[model samples]
Target chain A: MKLLAALLSGVLFGVGLAVSQMTNPAKVQAFLDVAGAWDPSLAFVMAAALVVSSISVVLARRRSQSLLGEPLQIPAAATIDLRLIAGATLFGVGWGLGGLCPGPALAALSTGVPEVWVFTASMLAGMLSYRWIFRVAPIRE
Target chain B: MTEFTPVSATVGGLMVGLSAGLLLLLRGRIAGISGIIGRALSQPLGDGGWRLAFLVGLPIGAAAVSLATGRLVVEVAASTPVLVAAGLLVGFGTQLGDGCTSGHGVCGIARGSKRAIAATLAFMTSGAITVFAVRHLLGASS
Candidate 1:
């Protein structure tokens, strides 16, 4: 049941991303191209998602366990550090270049695009390299 | 600004939020794509089944909409080498940061996590600057 819920949630997230044009690299690029011919459509997506998530998170946090009785596993890292900033900076540079992040890249997998394959493979390799080098240290539990 | 689709974008955002929110409320987990993927790759046995299920569902979910509406269009605009570099950067950077837009932007902000907020700001600024430099200053569209 829990697994099913997780799958359903994933499906919902994917559909949402697809519907919002988040799967399109061009659309994302346009959104990020604030100084140029900018597209503000994606901002609405982020805003709407945050509104719903903020409310839900507030409600869910009061409970020690989830509705399914799983221990809440939200991030527990409490401090801001150079690692966080530096990592996000690198991710952002890549994001600006390709307009594909973890979620959209995964969601676009079934499209069978060669470029997606390249991006996905490289992204996975990157993840694996970090794991091998860093030993998958839990940055924050 | 001209390519804006407020209705669909808002609806999609709601869906994304619903997914993230539901995951939190039901499983007490952050719907963080990078974290989940990393775990799926290296986590211990009996620990990665759900992550796999979630990851599988990502493509399947998008595929369903494409099959039904036949409206989804996909093409990676960047060159193969560019895409590879971007992917590698994203993959490594997300791991090092411990979150991406979803983790830090959506789930973390919703929870009022300072680290998530800080990380999100850092990435947004970096992304904007990179775009300006690459697309504007450098004129390297590819």
Candidate 2:
């Protein structure tokens, strides 16, 4: 049941990416294109997503236990530090240049676009490099 | 005659929300691109299989959708060097922050994670600034 639910969710997320035209790196780049031919459509999509997500969360919490038979795991930290700021900046630059973040980029691969693979490969390398550089301690749930 | 369907942003958003929520509920994991990609990179014993499956599935899903609807549009205006640099930076950031927007902004916030809230705020601010600098200052565009 859990596997089915997770898979279903993944499919739904993919569908959302498709319908929003977010799977298209061009549209995302348009949003980043502030100076010439700037497009704010992605903002609208994000805003719409935020509203729905906020509401769904409120309702979902009313349940005693989630469908997978476990409580929701929330992050324990609360402060904003150099790590957060630096990370955000890095992520933003990537989004601006590549026009693909993790979700959409991964989704784009299914389309068999060569660029997507290149982007994903680099992203994976980046992720791995972090473990070596930062030496992240094992995260305990 | 073909039926006229409304482009429901609400429905689209709801579907995305549900998908993220469901993943959290079942896998005890946030549907974060960075984190998923991160785990895939480690290639730990018994790890690569699922990660490979997940990674492989993403592109396949898009391909299937494109086949069903129409061709998927892909645009990359940045030079290869710039794209590579950006990818490296994001990887560093995802690691330092311990989560991406999907994990923090969506999943973490939903679970009432204060850290996620802070991280999400930082993510948005940086994104806005990058847009300003690249588009306004540097003259980069799609």
Q: Where is model 2 more than 4 Å wrong at Cα?
A: A34-36, A138-141, B1-11, B43-57, B111-114
The residue-by-residue lDDT of candidate 2 on B1-142, one tens digit each, is 0111125334545556766665655544566656666765665324324344444545555666687778766766667777777677667677667777567766666666777777777766666667667667876543
lDDT of each: 0.86, 0.65
Best by DockQ: 1
Model 1, span A15-118: residue lDDT tens: 99998878888888888888988888878988999999998888887898999988988777798988888999999989888889999899988787778778
Best by lDDT: 1
Report the lDDT tens digits of candidate 1 across residue range B1-142.
2377899999999999999999889888889999888878886234538888888888988888788878677746677888889999999999999989899988888888999889988988888888788788988663
Model 2 Cα lDDT, one tens digit per residue, A42-80: 665555666666665665567666666656654466676
Worst 10 residues of 2 chain B by lDDT: B1-10
TM-score, candidate 1, chain B alone: 0.91
Residue B4 in model 1: lDDT: 79
Candidate that scores best on TM-score = 1
Give the CAPRI rating of model 1: medium
